[model samples]
Target: MASVNRFIQFNNETINTKMLHQMEMLAGALADAPYLKVTTRQLIEFRPSESSVSVSVFWRHRPKQIERNGYLSDIYLLGAGYWRHFSIRAWTKFKKASTELPNLKEQLLLCAEEFRLIEKISKERPGTADAFSVRESIYRDYHRDRYKQNKQKGFLADAFLNAAFLQLRGEEVPGSDGFKPLFFLWSGIFDAKSTRDCAIVVENMLPRLEYMLEEDMVHSYYTFGEAVENIPPFRYHEGIESEQRDQEEEIETIEEWFQSWHRETEISEAPAMEFELERGDSSYAEGGREEEGTGEIQQTAKGDSRGDHQEDNDAADRQTEKAAKQASGKFGSANNQVVYTEKRIQVQQDQRGNIEDWRRKQAPYVRALLRELKKRMTQRRQDVRHNLNAGRLSRNLLPLVIEERPKPFYRKTAPSKELDAVFCLLIDGSASMIDKLDETKQAVLLFHDVLRGLNVPHDIVMFYEDAYEASDAAQPNYFEWMHKLEDGNRDHAQEIVSMEAHEDNRDGFAIRWMTDRVNKRTEKHRFMLVFSDGEPSAYNYAENGVIDTANAVSEAKKQGIEVLHLFLSSEPTTEEQAAFYRMMYGNKSVSADSLEHFVEQTLRLLKRTLHLVIQSG
Candidate 1:
């Protein structure tokens, strides 16, 4: 059981996780990058390399709707505004031009460009004006307070930047009559349309402003082109002038930008060993037919119309192949570049004896659950027919048969239908499971035994990441198969007992990998049961891991595969833990406190899920 204070802390963490997930979805949708993640850091910026956006951590304390929307607006500005319109080349050029300027001046130039992007967003998305308005209101108040503090500390450079911010937003800066002329001169930034235009405006006003503000700002508050230089050069299609082509180019560039960011991270690390996984063929081509008179016009004119058609088909095929490769790359990242090592647990004589001993100890509970499941399945297959023309004759129906039709037979049973379902049981082998491993294995044994008795094809595997050897380039994950679908009714009690705690677990990646396998099954009903102790934890995958796992669960559900989570804990589950589980598994999650509870909950989930499968079938 958790203490009251600990419960409160868990509650807060759950809330933060939910909030982070919501923000991630919002940013990903706006940026049109579904894999994009959102997190809170010290500063607000878009990290294309990580495929993530960060909001300032300060916003976590402000719970008001205005503040919330203001931060949401910040996401929009970065995800949509900067991600879509702001060119990396232009940003790089601006950085080069500002290298020799004072820190204050450089910050002002960055601020100008930010406002220009914000203005563009307002014009394009009028509905977002209210959020941006809230943002402006918050920044004005923040700068005003900072201005007073900087002035009192005799930091003229910092105070001037604050004053300039206020003046740019049309707010008056007090006791700065001498600097009013410079503020007016810098106010032209509002009229600037492009980043270059903003830079020119800043450059023209910097000479006189530099003379007045001799001391450079003591602190740097602005971030311009934080990692833009790391991005690769944009590849533009020559002589592409159509609006649709331009839009396509922009979308492609944004995807490339994200890829480049990941590439940069990969380059910073040592070369990793490559692992391969089977992927499905592409279902559809991404883009439409190329323009008729593009570069291929001369070649097409040299050939007959039939040859031209064949050439077009060839081009489409190439495009589809390229799209498939791109999709495979994306899927690899989703797996966190894990090199999966599938091990078949080999039990020694002593281990086999121990496995049999444990199975004997758990035999009673397994039998009880198995009996209950069999009884329910029998009842589901039982049929009661009220009236029939043939089969068993009913004496009570004879009277009615004389006055009406001659229906005198009834049936008491129907043919039993075999279940058309498949099951996948994924166990978390993280170090935190050391204490609960015994109970978890017992519950898993029950699950396997009952499913095997019912003749259902199921798989059981334990997954974990090797934390000590994990790196940015490669994370080695192991999938220890206790029981495989091909194993049929073979009992693998020894393999189940062989399970031990490993280093860490990447829940999202593991879930997705299992989901892919389950998806390939031909069963009409599919189910994935995930067993874990707590939230996901892996290298560079704490908060994002939760969101990613939640997304994975949702994706599995969308694919018509039922996903249920069993949270195994040594102590009683608090309301906080339940809420946290709900975020990842929706309503299909159960937390077990004791050994008996673990087995009981697993039995109940299986019963309920199988009942649905029977009913639907």
Candidate 2:
């Protein structure tokens, strides 16, 4: 009993496997169908006006809790049956009739298709076919009675019910001439009175239908509307027109809801200054090496020397070769595997005035933050007067006079807070950031001025991929240094103002390179922050870039560097975006809805860090 329970399981995996098998069979069967294509992006969406349709990703997954007990769940079978009977022509006709017919034409079209599919399924999987047919028949009869009670002409609805009954029983129904042909398609396969007939039909048709579908030679059994009645309810077209208007109104309501959710916010920053930095051709220059001076002498000696002399020269040559190999090995060991090249991109001289004006406007904010940081770092000194005064406490000679040894305690001074940290601000210069460049510059300037005031070493860099020039042979990666840690000044503020969005972003490589830079710093605390608007995207980097960056972040964390990310997005983020951020940064990522929020968050982080530093000091 334990083993049996252990072997039994129910979950999405089981559901997906079954559904995937069904889809594969259907796809194989309909390889030649031109009206629709199977997809896993949406649920039962049929756009007859478009080239293909979409199926939901959840189609292959089901809740496990629903499959408890030994009860046989028909959910998977019903879904398979639905797709098995899917006919492009029927869907297209329905799309048209839903707009053209009033009362029951579109419903009739769907009913006819369902019957045809049920007949075909009876020949293959009778159990599934019967189950679906029963459900369809019950709903059909219910609708027919409802329509009759409402005094609506339901002639077509009655025909559909009769057809559904015939498909379910594989028997002729009385007074339904329009559904007789569909019944004949399943004649002699099963009987209405025998459950044994369903079992027998299933056993026989499984092999036959599976093979037939795989060969792609099975003729489509559905006619979509070949057996529909000639006349439907009265005023059918008018009813359909009314239904179409109602559907349109519902769609408009849905669109309004989405629009309300995505209402645009106001922009709060100026446009970035136009830069004059020319894109430089990044190419490796090869240098020539000089030949060894011993070349001629060694050759001549080897040629002229006789027996013993030749052996001596050969031995010397061997020693020289070994020494040369050692030297080359050392040089090779010192060579960098990934050579990173970076330079400061100069701003246009004419734009200096505009840059200065912007900096002045932002000066007050920077100065206030600097003052707060400096105040937090300020230290207090205490003094003590005594015989032996060093720093904080003094010696007590009175105790020595009372026969106790003279004990001296120095008056120690409290040490000032040391900014023992390295900060790396890696900015995404992807083209999507073109609109947010100005605000990004302001944030960068604030970071720079704060760190500069605290005398902390930090590097400001903008990294992006030249999407246009990138190729398999050469991946054009560009990184502009706005400020270097070694420079110790914000004189390069112009570079930040001149920053502009460029092309695609390869975040993984950039993070890795910055990680390497931070790893080299001597500071006890290392911090690297990324500012990006979206996922890591580039011409060949879309799918793998996210994973690669995540791995790189893990590597940074392993090296004791704290990696944080700022999502610089203006619009309300979707679930997909949130999931992506969580995957990339875990709990270390924060989102900013606008430029103002971005500034506020940055200041908050700075103040918190300063407070912590002050407390530690």
Candidate 3:
């Protein structure tokens, strides 16, 4: 017996470009509002690899809707009110919200509930429907200017939810009785599955939440930026008791002990040769037998011999002595003591053959490495000496004060300064880079090589989704990703290069995490590089898609951290791939067709931008 209103089918379309624009509006509104808590910057780029985009979309958000419901919806990270269900008094608040909503959904829901109640009561009264109809007509008088106030207060409570009411005349929906259906309309379309999923969350709550819009505060912001300050030193004199005086003195003593701790003279790990070991002649490795000779002298002359420094030189020295003995004081025989020794001949012949093979196969690579090493030797020496001088390690007192030689003991490698800088890598883990995983990984590896060659202090990272999912291991690459703290070196990227893939999409978390990490680290030269295919959707965020991930790139740029953007998709358009423009904003974005190309381009860009020396190789 519920009083039925006219019905209108719900505009059950998915999110598309218009929806993304609406998100941008919402993000901008929240970012400017200062009352809503938001962590986002601005729109930077967009993507559908193989399809280029000219712009990016961004957002800011709060929990404004529910998650799972009925057979109509699917779960997603970025959507309206996903976390609101986890709050305290959700049922009470939501129900209360139904009475004072600012938009169509709430109004429709509130009307239906009231209609059902009055209709039932009308069954006992002869003219109940007529009486309630008159009351319903004036319901607006009881709820006037409410939704208007929300819009004035900064929430998009009206336009975003255009409403339509319909009353079905025939046999109605199973549990719906004769009540009308309230349809919520939006101007965009998204994927079908996602649209269906979003619908489920709206079905049951729309009727009840209409009234709560007036009570809830959704849009707000907080302050964040670096600013150092001065403040009084903390003192806890009031908490001290009379008996603790001695303990305070003990603490001072400990502090003094720490102050006097040794700063210089740790240990060095570079291997060095202190003394020479004897080497042997080629014949020493072979048997002492020889070829045709008029005498033992001729026989010995035909055999091989090697240098005195050679291992097993003992055999040659011994053989010389034996020959001298046979000559009986012929050590320097003026007679025919032909010095054509067996050992010398053999060594010459073998050395010539070995030289030919090495020259043909291994010389090029060896020479390249040697030249590079020699070019850097001076820099390496200065680096070691300068770093050691600046570090907490004290000067080498042993070289002057301790005249006596110290006993040898086992030593282990000290903590490496080579691992000194903190790195933040932001990767665009979107759909466009799906098949280009190998190339992206190669770019990462090439970066590793460049750093080692220049002795540049650095680390690696990638941005995927809005949040960061680090490499699974201590080291990460395109195939595998890890956020675990690790030192950078020639082999530092091996583990990551062996990884599988970054996830399928973006949520903006990774960029935020990268910014925060760079902000927190002390290294001014720290690097943050982003590799992506460029399609960044504002969906999949923690609080609907309230924060803009792209402009967050701009925010990071302002912080002075070095950011590199590398795009690995041939998809004509990719997300934010302008390197020079990125540099102007404080990041480097590279757009390339393949991984190999990315690697080459990154190397060239890094050397030019960082002013790092390129070794011979």
Candidate 4:
């Protein structure tokens, strides 16, 4: 099936994942919380206990500049304002006290406390004024619009809340005369330096406003504290008591320490097993000890069969130990403790027939692409030098001879220089690719056929992890080689067709693994193309996978390997998805909307890359 590429326009502002990552980092730095993770959620929240912050996705419909400013302001508000200055314990108590109040007054109390925290932080950090200014403007406009709508809809409580927000921001309220006493009471919140003060002001104003406002507000403009209701009042005391118990348990007497050390020494010195050496026919003894003078054990007689057999076993044991150590060497980020194995596909005869059938079906498209690539390569390889003084003689020089300037010799350099490059194709074999597997195989087949046609030494491997069996101690990833560089130009179409969808994809680990292999190649140009349907998903890897993959891509580039990503999807690629892929692969990513588009993109990428290689050569 052919894939169609469609262009669509979206009205809402989309968040760029790369930019979001940067913002998260910035938030972490500003908040002095290095591990803080910022994400987009339905509501804006600040969870200091969890070291995370969430900005609302509701800002997506805002203008691009406003959305960016709003996000930045929210980060500053929660990170710098709330994290450092807001008193969680005090806010928790105030929230508990307000449990019986109407939602409008409760929301107003939270909003007032937030404004006080913002004011405190802004005063301390003068540079945050611009972002706060944008924030203030956005809220003022929002509340003003909502106030008129609420009044028209006969929601007096909501309208009063909105009007109170406008009044606090120093904006004129439509019915300020009627709420003069409430406004006078709300003015005390501006002078509040603490959450308790803000809570008190809301408490005082509620007595007068509660009677006029019959219903609670429909929307919650702010959340003062998240998940604080379940906290025990004596939690701090309990923590101290636990620490005291731990300290008491850690103390030991000198005799006890000595006993522990003695036990460790006894364990280290358990016992040793010795093997007796065999002797020849004329040997004095088979198990000779070391002599006192020479301090050397007697050597076994030459050609002792048992000695040779023992030596062979010892050598095999050493080799096995060395192989095990090498296999255990780690890859990817330090947190990713994964070990991978490489295996050659064991293709069956029936699979070979399927491979041939698939190849036959894709031959026309392959031939067309092959012809185009060959033509481009031929054009690139043509070395033409004009107006040279030496080399091939030109007839135009005869005309210049009359003027005594005969320098029109042209040179045509040899066009047989082969491309000095190598390539690797990494296919994601996760179960999510089941629907796209057929097209993925076609693309791989195209990649294999084209590279083989060019006589380019390349490798094609499908990588996946055993999600069910993965763990922190040892995650087993497998690389099933369809074609390997060591195999030269051997036909592996059958092996390529044997690829099956597996459990999960750990893209960063796979990329780093392949980068290590390709980096060792002697080729002047090394290119690695990765095909995956979505972000990395593996045991304990979802959160850090995207960043780790991006770092892996960067590391490959630093090692002179160009990593390009092809995002395979069964539907049209969304702007958000494209941005996410771009975050990992930078501009080297291409999101294909269909199977045909996948093949087309793969060919286009190869052609473009090869053209550059040819030109560079």
Candidate No. with top lDDT: 1
**Which of the two, 2 or 4, has more TM-score?**
4
- TM-score winner between 2 and 3, please give it: 2
lDDT tens digits, residue span 1-617, model 2? 00101233551111122333234234324433322223333233332222223343332333443221101112322233344334433333334422222223333333344444455555665555444544454445544454344323444434443344445544444445644454444343434222233323333333333332222211111122222221112323454766565542211221222222222100101111111012121211122123322222222233443223523543554443321111111111111111223656556556677667766876887788778767655642233334442443443446556745454545433644567788899999888898888778878877887787778778899987777776533355667778777566436677788788888887777887788778888877788889888877765564345555676677789998988888887776655556667777767888887777777666766666666655554
Candidate 4 lDDT trough over 10 residues, lowest sum? 270-279
| Candidate 4 local lDDT, 1-617, one digit each (tens) | 11112245453333455657677788878766555667677667754333357876756777878778888878877777666556555655655654334687667876786688678878888887887788888888888898889889988778878888888888888665777888888999878987678878888877677677666777777654346442212213444765565442221221222233334333322211111123222223443444423323323333434322534433433333221111223354323356566666556567766677877977887788668767766766675777777877786756575756566778765544566899999999888888888789888888998888888899899888888877665677788778777666777787788888988888888888889899788999899999999888777776566666776787789999999999999888977778777878999999898777877888788888977876666
lDDT of 1 by residue, 1-617 (tens): 11212445434544355556677778878877776767776667666766677877656557578657867787877777777666555555655764334676668877786788788888888888888888888888888999999999989889988888888787888988878778777888878877667777777877877677667889776754246545544444677666645553232334457766655545433222121111111222223234412222111122333212433543443343221111123333445456556656544345766657667976786677667766766776685675677888787865574766766677766435567899999999999888887788778888888888788889899988899997766677777778877566777777788888988888888888888788888999999999988888887776667777887888788899999999887788888778888988898999887656887798888888987876665
- Name every residue pair that clashes in candidate 1: none
Work out the TM-score per prediction: 0.75, 0.45, 0.33, 0.64
What are the runs in model 1 whose C-alpha is more than 4 Å off? 1-39, 64-68, 87-90, 97-101, 218-221, 232-334, 352-361, 384-416, 594-596
lDDT accuracy of residue 224 in candidate 2: 24
Off by over 4 Å in 3: 1-423, 429-432, 462-485, 488-490, 537-539, 542-547, 574-587, 594-596, 612-617
User: Which residue window of length 10 is worst by lDDT in model 2?
Assistant: 265-274
lDDT of each: 0.72, 0.51, 0.35, 0.70
Best by TM-score: 1
* TM match of model 4 to true structure: 0.64
Query: Measured by TM-score, how close is model 1 to the native structure?
Result: 0.75
